[model samples]
Target chain A: MAQLRSLLLPTIFCLGGLMGNYFDRYTQSKNIVAEKASLVTTTDNKCSLGDIPSSAKEIMKFGFPSCENLKFREDYVLSYNRVHRTANWVIEHLTADKVFQRDFKRKSSMFKEDTSVPVLFRSTKKDYRNSGFDRGHLAPAGDHGYSLKALKDTFYLSNMSPQVGVGFNRDIWKRLEEYTRNQTRVYTDIYVITGPLYLPKESAEKDGKRYVKYQVIGKNDVSVPTHFFKIIVGDNRKKKSNAQLQLQVFQMPNEKISKGTPLDEYKTSLKSVEKASGLLFLDKASSLAIATDRSAI
Target chain B: MAQLRSLLLPTIFCLGGLMGNYFDRYTQSKNIVAEKASLVTTTDNKCSLGDIPSSAKEIMKFGFPSCENLKFREDYVLSYNRVHRTANWVIEHLTADKVFQRDFKRKSSMFKEDTSVPVLFRSTKKDYRNSGFDRGHLAPAGDHGYSLKALKDTFYLSNMSPQVGVGFNRDIWKRLEEYTRNQTRVYTDIYVITGPLYLPKESAEKDGKRYVKYQVIGKNDVSVPTHFFKIIVGDNRKKKSNAQLQLQVFQMPNEKISKGTPLDEYKTSLKSVEKASGLLFLDKASSLAIATDRSAI
Candidate 1:
């Protein structure tokens, strides 16, 4: 965290709770021009969520975890958190064709304010401008390689969460995303739900009781999650019933992670991730099948 | 030009002509994955060039100046020149609404090979990798604010010409682009033609006859233009006749230009740019009207 202090100035000494009112007003009207311009043209030939397979949609309902201020786009959807000024979860379905695409080059730029969000509650690029944390994408752009617009939509600030840039974002987290896409080779299509987790840990205590503790960055007090999670449900179209569905859940810390670490080492049950984030995922019917057919990591 | 030598090796000294066969074979297969991925998704409901107003279309016919292997996208069109490994010109029609967009951030990356062009003749980012010159966009991404996809399309290597980075690309040329966009405040829609100029001067002579002398960068032999040109045609749709049509043509040297220099100082005639590039623009019918009703610079 000393590196964090070096990169940021603790100019506003008040607690995160104290800046809510000011943050509300600032995000409401800031950067309107840039955000609005992109919205108008992006809607062309957008694919509707109705196109989402019903079985995949069923899992998405619970996996979203927190539905506060949910936002929808043709390629993906999310439940946004005005308090965190970031997404609670971003959900998308990646088909085999999307995973196979390699045409468009990545557009690497700073994250932008997601104008599609209600102005008062939207996050601004300024929130992370000089803040030490990288604006990491919960719904990775590399997965949407099939469509340029889908890839561009991923850049919207609402899809981003603050995460360590060096070892975490550029290293382990990136490898995890690549691994997820690589799984597309084995499944016909995959439904993904990715979000941050702020769970109670022994390292931080408030009022002599251990509680979940994380740093809040920028004027908006965007909560930096202690860890992040990805819940994946893969569809094996060849099977007749839900029996063929494959579920893989992973949770990783928001800290330096070694490059060669096996992904199986970080595997966790959906039930565990749900408890930490306090969000339900998968209905009992689907959960029962997963429990019976679960494969050993 | 001397500054360029400092940033690039003066290797393969025979001439720009010597490596044509090698460049032809290499660009054909290099970076196949990145370029091919984008072409698949970009074809969604593309806006046709026929949508351009008759008057604007007439002007574009010549401003594209050459119809050889013309490439068309939703927002703009250009004629690809295999020898130069860049567009002879990129022509676009911009409305007031477009000039005002500010939402999306610029994607900063090195030039990529344009897959839309014939692979054997296209330019690659590697050509400019250590060549010291910037892969400057003939069609500035800033002007395509109306659509993020349009802005992204501007990144294709076919639309780029090698430019001096610091003083030219960053300073004067950037300001000129801003000036052009600012004109949107007065005109309803504007037609723009921008490209490189490989004009011969008295100083560069062979056999006492002036010959075009320009540097070739990288192993690909991508030609570096000595100057650049921009021809803008603005239409005041409110006016019923040709009285509303306004044209401004400018030519700037590919060297350091002071920020404070007045734009009028660079103003030239379309005929001059046409003669130097050996391309005809604004066919006889439209040329007659521009000559008779040309506005003062």
Candidate 2:
């Protein structure tokens, strides 16, 4: 009986691996179709809207975190959080073709309210004025420098969150964005999902209770997220059909980080981010090749 | 010239009133059809599911707050907030027939996890067990005493929030629920929408900044809302076609409340609740019959 069981184990493992690969491909294709359909609808709404690019389809090849108030832009897509007057999450597809092309300058882009959103829920420039915190971009402006419209779209208040300036947004957060862009040189395609998080912290009173606290800036009451997260997927599609996809998840505190702090220290598991953000990541990917080895970072 | 101006003023007022009434009826009928269609889909899901009751249709006469994760129950319908492990809002259609029927007793109902919700986001009875807060029902069980299944449905953890037990949930909150049921005697139909709110409060440091803070309980991290809100719309449908509809909105803190404090003190404008909750109320209604006179309370 022991010999028979051992013989069956190998066969079962082979079948499971085949099924996983098949399912992953099926899901990837299904998501691409759905995303393309949505982009088509967006194109129909605006006559001047740019052509639907295949890059958008490849970016959302895995799956969407959540489908609510989705704004399909020229270079990226974001789900706006109407209540918080900010984005729930933003998806950006990075490649050597787009990130390397620098046709537009950031100087001409202006921060403006997203007129597509209802006036009642819209966030404005006045809300961020004198509010000490910087209007941080979720889809970094530098990533969309390939097109003038895409660069300007990143400046919408809907894409902005109230982020700390000196030590956080401008310093460590910028480094992370640059690091993500640098990966385009290594991987053929890079898909990124970035969003804010309101995490709970254990109270100081030792009352055995946890509390979530975050400041609201401006009249719109835009929530200053306690933390921010990014999930990066690196795919080398040119490789064999069974080529592994590299996954890396990072979560950073909204406050200041010392200059010497290693970026690897912020790395976290995908499950932790999903639980905290109330969002699921890459569910369509039957198997995630999480770069568990520290050397991968 | 004075005579002409006075005549035009009255004519303009009359025209505005006519348009408002016509628009209100048109919107109301549209909502009814949309809600009925949704109920039909819910019915098709489970063969054993209870029949589609007209009460559920009447409860949602005003359009839904937001359509994300909706759970259509026997007597009440709610939009579940998967992130918070609680209902975004629960709507109950109260009437002289349902609330006063007393066909089911509360003792027979048991607090159980809602299996309909995904296991990752579901809250359990264990989460509330020693959590220092009561499993307060957003749709009060007493409001569904007419049917055994309806009463038991209210016990689902999805319908609960971590509410203060003694001074709040049991004492003042109970009174408010009872008060809502009693309104059925006056109005032919009383539609109540109850939900939790994490309202922002100004900090004590005089820094001129506002913050939202709330406690979370157990492994599931079910949010303990800082406040609760109810929007009560009373309609006397039996009256003339142009009869007015009463609108009353209230918001209460999640902490303790004194016994002597009048419930009227909690009454607030609908606009304030909408702004804070990130929801719209009765947008389909042509005009609100706001009981401006304190005597109406």
> TM-score (0 to 1) for chain A, all models?
0.75, 0.79
A35, model 2: CA deviation in Å? Answer: 16
How far is B41's C-alpha from truth in model 1 (Å)? 30
Model 1, residue pairs in steric clash:
A34-B102, A34-B103, A35-B103, A103-B34, A103-B37, A103-B38, A104-B38, B62-B65
User: What is candidate 1's lDDT per residue for A43-127, written digit by digit as tens?
Assistant: 0111111123343354353233332344555477776755456777788887778767856556643457776454444567877
Instruction: Compute the DockQ of candidate 2.
Output: 0.12
Error of 2 at B146 (Å): 0.5
For candidate 1, give the lDDT of residue A99.
Answer: 68
What is the C-alpha lDDT profile of model 2 across B1-297, one tens digit per residue? 844442332233223222322111101122221221111111001001112366665676655566545677888988777678898889888889999999889998999988766666789888998999999999999998889999999999999999999999999999999999999999988889999999999997889999998999999899999999998888886765655778788899999999868899999877677777766555344433433422253
* lDDT tens per residue, model 2, A51-160: 23666656666655665566778888887776787888999989988998989888989998887665556788998999988999999999999999999999999999
Query: Clashes in model 2: which pairs?
Result: none
TM-score of candidate 1 restricted to chain B? 0.75
lDDT of each: 0.60, 0.72
Scored by Cα lDDT, where does model 2 land? 0.72
